[model samples]
Target: MLSGVGACPAVSAAEADTTDNAALNDANTTIIVTGLKPDEGQNKISQSGALGAKTLFDTPYSISVIDAEDITRRQANSIGQIFANDPSVFSSAPSGSTNWWGTQIRGLGVRNYYIDDVPLLLYWGGDFPLEPIESVTALKGLTGFMYGFGAPGGVISYRTKRPTAEAMLTTEIGYRTSSVFYARADAGGPLSQDGRLGYRVNIGGEKGNAYNQAGINRLVGSLALEYAISPDLKWYATATYEDSNLQHEPFQFYWANYVGNSLPRPTYDYEKLNVANSYYKARTLAAATGLDWTFARGWSARLTYGYTNKYHRSNKMFVYMRNQAGDYDGYAYNFAELDQNHFGQAMIQGDVMTGPIRHQIVTGASFQQTDSAFGYNDRDYYWGNDFNGNIYQDQPFRVTRAIRFGTGGWPSKEQQRALFLSDTLHLGEHVQAMVGARHTRYRLADLDGNPLVDSGYRTSAVTPTLALIYKPAPYASLYGSYVEAMEPGSRVGGEYANVGEVLKATLSRQYEIGAKYEHRQFSLTLAGFRIERANTIDRLINGARHLTQDGLTLYKGVEAIGSYRFSDRLKLGAGVLHLGPSIRNVSAGNEDLRGNIPAGAAKWQLTGSAEYYVAAIPGLSLHGNLRHSGKAPTSDSNTLYVPAYTTANLGFQFNTLIGGRKVTFTGNVNNLLNAKYWTQTNIGEGINAAMSVRLSL
Candidate 1:
């Protein structure tokens, strides 16, 4: 990892210069592994959430890592796109609205995001940015013990690229369909002798009409710097900013509220669904400072403080042309919102041996708070008009503008405090066990930011994790683990007599068993898991009605992941996931839905990618990838479905020495077949493509 005399809390700084190291044992250090060559084999993930740097084979949980080098070559435009191809992840393309950042892992919504294991809350930001990020680590099960209170689905951890030991500069330019263009520059290096100080910075912007009238106007930048106070201590800070003005691009169905034949999915040239004048814009700024202290004799501490602020406004509009007539008014709404979040954490770790058993332990405390406000105004432009003309026929219609916003006030306020402890026990040469627990104090307030009742509804819960592992050979590892997570209860107000009362935190659990095999330059992982949670309902107890938690919503699945480096010129990767979800012991009202497939969920998903360098072209290669999702139920009623879909992509890359500098040019044609499909509640689709050039200095 990046350090002076020992492993610092951060990863390594020379990630860009390593290419011949293919061994996983030495790959745990921080460096965005860019899988650009066959020798570049190790794509190590961040072990912060796991308490130590363990390779994928050494870790007890199912996690996946794909570094930035892999991402840039894949033509992924957003962080979600980079991970969406994994079958285990359920991703929806952003409509550039409040729900843009939504992602579901293991059948549950995942909201907790981390940078180097530190928590961050994006209360109102429509999207989770991919800018300035160098690598990504995704935890695929309950993570309450690893982070704190959050969805049971898991956590997405991001690591920013550290300053390179050698100074260099890189610039990239790209263009896509719909008249969009972008440019970015990256530079980093040490600023003092013995590398006592270093810095890395990234700045970029994109503009013009992009993908279906979303009309993009975006800017992103970040600066990260670190200073070594001594051989045993260091200080680091980063400031990041992003701003965007995006036109609202609504999905055609808006199906959650209106399903079945009565509300037919609309179809128009996918490009026409976006109103030229409708828009959603937002800006976010965040800064964080941290300390990494390493004491003599296996003891160290890591701490960080962070602050984030965001503001956004939108004039959201959606057009449905399936049933249409003369120009009728379209639905529109205006909203303005703001959010602020403060986060902090302090952790200490130590290594010691008890007799023949060795122990590695970590203890930490965390705090997070968020305050937000929002308001909206609604209007119907078609309210005064009849059918003007059909939009699909290219009949131009006047775009309405609304500049007024309703008064806004704080609608929500939340705070959480937590203390956690974890230990890894080494019992023998081939056996190890991990145990951990977290105690959390959490509370929520009403819109007025006041307690629901007297002092407000406050509660606490304890979550734990246990795991055992065995490694019979250097190349193989097997493990089984059980973990539980919690989510704050649904809060209600004044209408009820017990208004101030708060339901206990809902508990969710997961049990998993997995095996990992690493031989030569290939890696494979196979696992099976089951997840469950209980639902609370009113029941008669002693002739009196009381809320009782019972019944189970269960999700079970099996998954396989593998990657191979066949030769100096060939590389390939693939994954498969399947889930079976059902509700058992449901209440009378939901009895009929028992065993029914859940809504917006695909039973099967698969992804694969390959790259082959051509011996004949000297510096040329072809790359292709495919993604598939099985048909999914559109709603809880199971009366309608979103058909199964597959998307194919093909691209090519050419690399060569240009004036003593290396330059790579690449391009891809996404949705190459233009197959119409629904990404969610939408029903219009089209062909998309992007091309870019990168020059290294």
Candidate 2:
């Protein structure tokens, strides 16, 4: 069984400094493990922004971790694939989409993501190669107190692979459906004999045809270096580069503006259609450096700085159905944008005592700046006529070759600065209380020199968090928490009356209570949560659509998940989530939208997984997964719906020794039944397969 393949949260700087070297040495000895280790702390919890670490039973948050082993076993190539079985996360795009990273957590949209605890300013257009990542930590609910400023959807952090104490090398090759092949190499060792200086390097590339005759190509590389000056001080740096292209990709369908109240059937055979002249290209370069120092016993401090530059360009069509006959108008747009981010954070944490109360205090400051600019040669071209083609027929690039246009010249800049502090008081052995707050200053400027956004927008807010925990036993606990968060409002698109306008910052709040149990062979977590926030919506005013923020959006849900190890050879895991999300208190032309379910929010979700080890064989195992999502509203007004769907996956792995070195092989058939389904309300996904082999020396 895959006994040790569950969430293994995170660790603080001091805790990592004490355990990483030893753990790395032990990890390289085997490609798989039969059971969990005592020191793994699989359910421990730590905030990405250097918050002090705590065991899962003591922390007052819902968190999950996906490690490298799980990534390899599942052959996951994108963020959506990594969390497909998680009931709480919903992806809005398929893996091949340029905006695949867009997701909704607990019914709210996620606005930011982190790399090695440093927040990067990303919207819906970035993806990292999984080859060099160590783990991914997903913290659910509001995060303003632990983090500085963000959406209420949750926090996601990625930790990159690091140098190992012992010399090691591994090579792997893989194949996917439709003639895709790839290879990768990972090597790490100490540059100095004393093991004080170490380095790790990874490189990979892939190129092949995709399921629907689309083409895919990718190249990625990363390097990480660590230097330990002494037992109490350490410094590290990391750099990564990725370039990828998706050719002949499909576009998202939009029918709200064209149809009154009609829902289209999901009958398009995506596996056979090839829409030419539609492609996406992205290039990313990023670097980060950090220092960790243990100044005294039970006291530590950390400082980190990171920078990212991302460029993406795409030309894709948007389809708008006209009538029940499926006739549609196709509009293609050529778009390109450049985004740059600079981020820095400094933090200190330590333990102190006052009489009988023990306090763990943490304080930090963080700042981020982002600059965005659009290409000058961008263009939007229309086909010859309004009704160009039908959805059931294939449209080629030649149909729009004669149309020409040019669009461009827009830029915006944003800055955020925050100071945060938290204290967790240990009241005796069974009770604890925690309080935290973050004071943030945010500003957005329209660099386009347009009067539409006069002096831009400036705001300040103080978000807070409070929590209480009671431990009935060392392995179980009950806790409750409340948090407040903030996010900058979205910029109005060109089609809206308020183009180039920047709205005021939005505020969100959340309340949660949960219970957790982690014993010898089983683990369980149950939580109920409620979130409220204001959203940006567009309404027809005076025959023109204007973007405005009004009313409140409410999301209340219950989640239950657990895993059990029935024996040495069998393991099972399952989770279920039910969400009640709606919009309320709207006036003007949008009163009809009140009490309607929001788009992309599923009312119910269920997931199950199983892994079994062949006790008769030395090193062989089988695994399977199932996921179901209920029907979801396709629009904010609930006039359109996407029906419920289910997908399943099956796979197996084998490990053996070859030439006195460890070797492993794995294979998987995703969508084993070749289920035809929709990833988003309008995006479709097809069946695929993957197989790989790895050799360690």
Candidate 3:
């Protein structure tokens, strides 16, 4: 607990003085258990990803935590791979697109993501490898009441590793299919004898071919520092840098836009399907700092600030469209963009008493701003040809090069500010009620200095939440909640009457009820939720996305996640979920789409994992996984569908001593069946294998 007292929720004056110097400093250090002496609050819920550091059973929400061990065991390198274990989410993108975090949660795109509880706008455009990530928390459903302005999809908070109490160093070497090889290092230690100042650092690099003969090269590095100024106060800071390049962009397909008619999805050989000589280059730099303080009994305060900058450019020609005959109509475009983001938050939390009722309250203010500029340079030449070789074979760089085009504006700037308050009132020892609200002011500005309708407009909203939880027993809890959110809207296209106009923020609501049970090392959760968004629309103009609000969009789903420890040597983890989304209420002309399933939304998802440790062998372990995603709509008409597919993976780990130090070796094979299927439109990676070795001292 923040009070540093016992497991009890109550805070004593003397114990509160000890503060949360160690707890508040790390955004995710609150609930996750790790290291030699696992955190005492592992099974006990903490407000780590929510309003405060309160027990989970006392709170009303559906949440999931993915820890580092899970990451290592899965060998998941991308956001898509990481989410393969969770049925409640879909992580996939067009092969040639640079959108990495383009995953969907509960049938809605995760438009934004957070780092250390600080939002990083436009996350997809600037992808970061999971080299140093320590853990992640998925907070599902309406969150504006606890957070601020954001998509109703949910919030994903990424927490990186911090300095450990004990000095440590590790080195690893890994290999993947397509001749990819990489190396990494992690080291940390206390900077002072008093155990107050500490630091952790990670550095990694890779160079090799990626899927579909796409050459790849990249480097990633990060640094984390922490200083305990006093027993009651602490400060922390982090900085990161990443640079990546693709020698040849991967293959991309526009099913409906291409071919212009319904036809079975096409398949191509790995070497014969990708663009040749096309390239994508991206670079990013980020920094963050924060402070935590406990100044009075039963009270604590925190402040955090972070900033990020990204630059990306790409030129490719292999991305194409197919006519009725399946003949290719090649496309060539030069894309470039610059994005900058800033975030800040301040919070105060404490315990208060109202007669016989005990209330835990948290109040906070947060601000976020993003400035971006982007444009595409088009080519004057075109190619109409198709041969197995045409996919990856290039005529000449000069012939396919994109020429500078007329000026095209961008979404220059967006800002959001909000204040939120929440309270957990103990109705009795076994019953509690959680309530919260948020007021947000959001605005977007046009940098081209154009004065069009809805240009430089501002909008405001107030969202609220209420939930009740009943802890019938220490090992089980039941809860239900109702929450709402405000999602910033988009600017209308020039095709519309009010071109260059900004739409009012979309209002979304959610209802959820769930149960959680935890015993020893086993845990299980079952949840059902429904989400509705007002004013939703999706349309296409000249093969480009033109989004506008019409009426409403409703998405609902149910999911179950659980882990079972069968014995000291065996364990299992699994998840299953089903989602149904439809475009409701629309104009007369667009009524055909009403009651239609949203394109790209999957109907069912299931995942299972198993592992075993060999006691006699002392350091050997075995692991395997199975994942299935049912058929998904590929077009607004719902007639074009991507067939359902299943994939399996197997791996094993061996830990032993190297010169009296610890060394771990791992090997995994993915796509055991080499299944041919599409994840996004026509994007898919066939069979692949990887292995890694790590030595610690």
Please list all clashing residue pairs in model 1, or write none if there are none.
Answer: 2-11, 11-30, 12-30, 326-387, 326-388, 326-389, 327-387, 327-388, 327-389, 329-382
lDDT per model vs. reference: 0.65, 0.72, 0.67
Candidate 1, position 671, lDDT: 67
The prediction achieving the highest lDDT against the true structure is 2
Badly placed stretches (over 4 Å) of model 2 are: 1-42, 258-263, 271-274, 322-326, 376-387, 398-408, 449-454, 494-497, 542-545
In model 2, which residue pairs have backbone atoms overlapping below 3 Å? 1-613
- Each model's backbone clash number: 10, 1, 4
On residues 389-449, what C-alpha lDDT tens digit does candidate 3 reach at each position? 2433443333343444223445467888888888989887888898888888988866553
Among the numbered candidates, top TM-score falls to 2
> Once superposed on the true structure, which residue ranges of model 3 sit more than 4 Å away at CA?
1-50, 94-97, 123-126, 258-268, 316-328, 376-411, 449-454, 491-501, 535-546
Tens digit per residue, CA lDDT, model 1, 601-669? 678888886767676665566777788878777554576666778877788866655665656687877
Tell me, what's the RMSD of every candidate? 6.9, 4.5, 6.9
Q: Which ten residues in a row have the lowest lDDT in candidate 1?
A: 1-10
> Residue 117 lDDT in model 2?
71
